[model samples]
Target: MKMDLKSKLLHAVLGAFFAAASPVFAQETPNVVFILADNVGFGDMGPYGGGELRGMPTPITDQLAREGLTLTQFLVEPSCTPSRAALMTGQYSIRNGLSLFIIPGTPNTLPKTAFTMGQLFKDAGYSTAIYGKWHLGIDAQSLPSAHGFDTFYGIPPNTSWDSAATVPGVMLSHSAGDVPEKDLIDKGPWIMEQKAGGELKKVKPFTLEERAKIDVDLTQKSVAFIKEQAAAKKPFFLYLPFSMGHSPNLPSKDFAGKSRIGEYGDKIMEGDHHVGQVFDALKEAGVDDNTIVVFASDNGPTGLEFSNWSALGAPDMGSSGPFRGRLGAGTEGSIRTFAFIRWPGHVKPNTDSYAMFSIMDFLPTFAAILGKELPKDRPIDGVDQTKVLTGESEAGARETLLSFIGADLVAARWKQWRIYFKDEVRTGSGHLQLGGADTGFIDRAYPSVYNIEMDPHEDVNVGGNFIWAMEPALKAVMEYEATLKDHPNPKPANVTNFGGN
Candidate 1:
């Protein structure tokens, strides 16, 4: 399915012709390109808070926000796998068995039973592909192609961390483009997957220096896929979950020293460059006006009052803007992520929406755009926001959102009030100020609460006065628990179905 240079150009021309004729034959369904950044902070971009402080050049992301609506209250799960699972299935990860961390070479696949957003769009005749991180599962049944994507590539589990995959004497300088075919190998711990949920077809015994440029390779592949699909006269659903700003923050040689804050900032700048490339590709394909491009993070930043890594100490981890806490703490900073949506001619440009929108809402919202009803067999935690997205309405409400550290519901945001059922306190683990939290410290007597409308940072605690506010939230959780009891997640563990292959 990989296209060569000439083939890509030919397909691009054909696709353009078909697109031009599309207006006469049928009303075109919008193509969707969802970009999810790994461990990006709430204030990492120019539109967010990092623009003024951090010297990372994020003009593309900022321009995208200016050309569309920037959502201030968009939320997601505090971790990678859980956020992705909720995003794809429109259900909480706790019910889906992906609430915990996903280890490599382990049984951490999402269930085949759960109908995903990819399947929904693919079933509707959209050409679907996912290039980049697919952390849902490493197994065949749990891979991206199995979950409704027609083509899938890139790292299955995750990239190698500095603590694990460092090597010496590797070449460090190269153009941010495709590597030579002769350098490809099929043996290495960090093998880049090629087939759709298939075995490792390509790998290389590359040094850590070479591996650092994976984000660039992913971007090239993604743009090529977009062009190929466009040539085929088919609309596409491209889910590009970038592996940047994660641990072992490695920027490509082309982007080295591009940022003022060093390696992590360089990676962010490089990531924004890739975003610009994608946007440019859309425009080149003549589908810029019709394409629905959504940019957001899987979770919050990697630093702050939570788990601290080397990148954080480089003082390079993104800021959480005005929020507090970091990833995996069930705080506002952990769940509140940057969200921007752009659709030309439909959604108003340069507008801001404070509507509480969850990443889970995407599936139902997309379904609404297709004028199709969601399947009635199961419960969906997402609400349709067609009006909210199209600029027809300024007001929207998710009303309640549950934040979890693992299987435990640590915090619940009910409208303006957020109640913390469990206290997450950071403890020094011999790493000085760099520490991890001692989770599950439930305070039954005086659980801390915050009015999010007044104090978005969660600094002031008014648990006693807002104790009554938890009444309706607790009832809602009770009702949700009842539904889960009825339609329990079948694979509340990994999707371990390997048929002797």
Candidate 2:
């Protein structure tokens, strides 16, 4: 066979073109933007029934539901740090070694080796930036930059809202703000090094004014980052975990009194406005149609002072729709919160799905989108719900979900049944019980079981009569608990009395 050199070269070029175009020819890559609201209730939006939002109304949130898919059965851990940890690792908080609320000085932190959503997306060729709250850990090693984000702007923890006398972590700001020295003071049992320009420096305490300004500056930085990424013509994964609705309900002057429900409601409205700004920025950059926007809360509303004001008159302000219990409890209200996804053309407009999904599902779902494989050796608690979100599947993606309260496995939501291992009303700052004596681990004498589909409020306890029927589900929970001890990651520092205030 005698082939000419020119002909051979032409064939080689054609082959190279086909090989490079294979992926694009098979799939379309979409930019992803995940927006996480802090302590915003399930019913705090117009679509979910929060009454009038801002001044005019919350048309932006409702517009998302009308134009995309709304997840009615989405769930997350009861608190901020645990929820964020589960979300990033695609595993239960216990498995990731972040089982409790990560206090400022807690020795426990998310290990760098663990996989995060940002890491996965970045490996898959997406530019990742995390704006807003990063409550997982405050150390530079635990910052978003180290966790695979190309750019990081925002407060390390929402605990910055706590008085200077209370919290021990520092607030890192990218703009001008007065940071309290105490805020930067790390009374930690762990050591941290800060990296700026290629040099490492030891961080010290700062002020609340500095921390507060950091949040505001981060919003501006986020807007700028999105614009820059869009200009570069690259796919981006922007994880905006806002701190507006969490605590110290400090709404900007413009948003104050915008809502009739007091400071908490005003803060929520402020969060909504920031969300709208992000969307607007995307539109301005001409990436709105190609970006997948997800809006959800880390957990339910906090029963703090400001939030209580809304509870007094506006029941809808912090309502978890038909769910019971608030934040920090094993009840549905604590775990089940607002979740909305908007992807133009791919998802059905104004469509809503009641399929059960969890925050841990984000990593797997994003993996599915990027055609990335999950770690085979590690057990991933999240299921691939990409089809469910894209309107390709109507059935629930997960059959059961294990909810952990600190190190304890307190609740399990399987099918329509939700089993609460103990009865304890979460009060005070910590997600701890209110009464004097501690209600030890499992009050096996009387576990509460509710067919959530029928009694979403969890008012009726069916455990006594349906004990035999729930045996199989209970056995499943026990089996799952046993697997936790064998998790490949090392156990985190035990947090025995961290939450009880």
Candidate 3:
């Protein structure tokens, strides 16, 4: 059947429209480098508030804040594994079935069916590499290679420098069985083979003094990877999750005593130094302008051994700024964190945005950058905030965020109000009062309300007289919880009970 003149013209017009739009889409692809810092606090950086620790003002991190957009209301899960999982999948930890840190040698792991950011980039013809901690899962099936990373050069699980089998005070991995330390050393490819029971088995022949040198060597390798990828003209996605400032608080000898606040401060400075190396690598490769660099923490400070309360004559080393509570608690202090992004010529410089964002949004945001669409069947709790990052929009992409404290969903942030399903815990070293006793758990039935816009510190709880006013926000939270129940539980494993027997 021959088309009439009107029909033929219509087809020609449609063809031209698609042709014009195709090039615009092709030219929009940009390289992404997501830098995740472990256990970093909101006010830990020099740009934020660390002048007391570093004299004469260290300006490397401060420069990023000056030249990029700072996310004032960014948040993450309370711990490393859940936050990492959320960032990688663009879904909540509960949705992905990885709500807790994956126990070594357990059946629980990030399921192979779920898609990750690395996989998304790899599918789009981008080279992806992760060079740091992979604490989400340690099983063979959950390895970085299987999760869409083209190459991985970091610890497969949470192994540290203190393990006896490794070089004195250097991170190491051992084979996955009861192999002798001597046998592990004999078996080559030293870093990949780790003992099964989370022990570092074979020590490299490096002397005790040489352990600090290993960190430098890792930094060099990471820089080399960036250089190589740039030379090949490949747009790369590098996930650098550093282990510094987490535990054992070890920095190189040169950096030790560099801060007035002791080891904790020294480690913070060292982490900034390593971040500078990554920036230098990008600049050296001539890809700094085109690459989008995002720096954020996995969660709040651990403060177990290096509590600021004890070290600096303060209550905690890492401050959550004006937010209340600390790591592991449901307060803003635990979830709210530092997030900064640099994309030269794209993002506005030295600007602070109050747009509510989260680690859960990274995957979707990256997908938006690459012009990829998420699967419709997979319900993503995160929205593409590329507009907010690029200064095209000012409004927060999310109206509400669900927060999980331990095993239960305890609170939700909606607009200016944060509605807690449980009793709000007191901030800083105070015993949580539940049932007239000192119970550690933040009670959930009382439903405290805080106007975050006015009182970020959460000093006053207005839930008493405003129950009627808070009904809408509280109802929204319940509806969200119900939606999760209707869907298949992403993680089906039993919640491990670690209470004293």
State the C-alpha lDDT per candidate.
0.75, 0.71, 0.69
Instruction: Please provide, for model 1 over 348-377, each residue's C-alpha lDDT reduced to its tens digit, 9 standing for 90 to 100.
Output: 999889888999999999998877777787
The window of 10 residues in a row where model 1 has the poorest summed lDDT is 163-172
- Give the Cα-based TM-score of candidate 3 against the true structure: 0.80
RMSD in Å for candidate 3, one decimal?
A: 6.8
Q: What is the TM-score of each candidate against the true structure?
A: 0.85, 0.81, 0.80
Clashes of 3: 12
lDDT of 2 by residue, 111-160 (tens): 76778897898888888877666767765566776777776554444243
Q: Pick the candidate with the highest lDDT.
A: 1
Q: Write the per-residue lDDT of candidate 3 for residues 130-189, one digit (tens) a residue.
A: 766677665566667777787665554443322212532122353345566455444432
lDDT of 2 at 305: 35
Weakest 10 consecutive residues, lDDT, candidate 2? 188-197
